[model samples]
Target: MAQPQPIPGTTIFDGIQAAKGYALNKMCFSFNDAGNRAAFKADEEGYMARFQLTAPQAEAIRKRDVLGLLAAGGNVYYLAKFAGILGLDVQDLGAAQTGMSKQDFKAMLVRANEQVIH
Candidate 1:
């Protein structure tokens, strides 16, 4: 797949602007805050449980491997949601957007969901 170039003037802030109605900033803030991180870590299993992911799916998330997460059936939207939660920058999002074909992206989402059921 041809890699996607960054959209000029685009930044994580742009993503935040695009996500105004989605509470993306709130999620990002929660994920970026040290206090929240500590709180999340305190009950990691429970938090992971909310995603209803299998062990390997959860493991993949812990590893922060985008391809692996995608291969395991995670939707890009949701993955993007998680990425936002992780404070992933727009550059990372652009890289992911550039990395695969549309069909491949759909397949990755299916695979990610399938893995979560295992």
Candidate 2:
């Protein structure tokens, strides 16, 4: 019998997929309704307050602080998407157990972004 292989872009951690789903849901919800989009756009401060992130955490995200997100238990793929939404670049953290380098993960992210746009 042959061992099963992971899907081309799947990560080992299930939590990472959950986090990405959650963020995508939030983004879609925010865009699907006029009121939601207005609320998000009208009060940037209050919009962030909804996440309940600490000041430093929010600041770190704003600064594209990959180290901080890692310290906060953020999944790198999800964090990259968050950084994308924030107009920031995702920095390479290192390699995964599957021998996928951080650069490979970033390229996967770019592909994911293209999928989202399409």
* Residue range 1-118, candidate 2, lDDT tens digits: 6645776633444565456334333543454456755665676567657766556555654665555555444566555545544544444444332345778877887898999999
Candidate 2, position 69, lDDT = 52
Task: Determine which window of 10 residues in candidate 1 has minimal summed lDDT.
Answer: 20-29
- Top candidate by lDDT: 1
What are the models' TM-scores? 0.43, 0.39
User: By TM-score, who's the top model here?
Assistant: 1
Q: Which pairs, if any, clash in model 2?
A: none
Instruction: List per-prediction Cα lDDT, in the order shown.
Output: 0.55, 0.54
Off by over 4 Å in 2: 1-44, 86-118
RMSD of 2: 9.0
Worst 10 residues of 2 by lDDT: 20-29
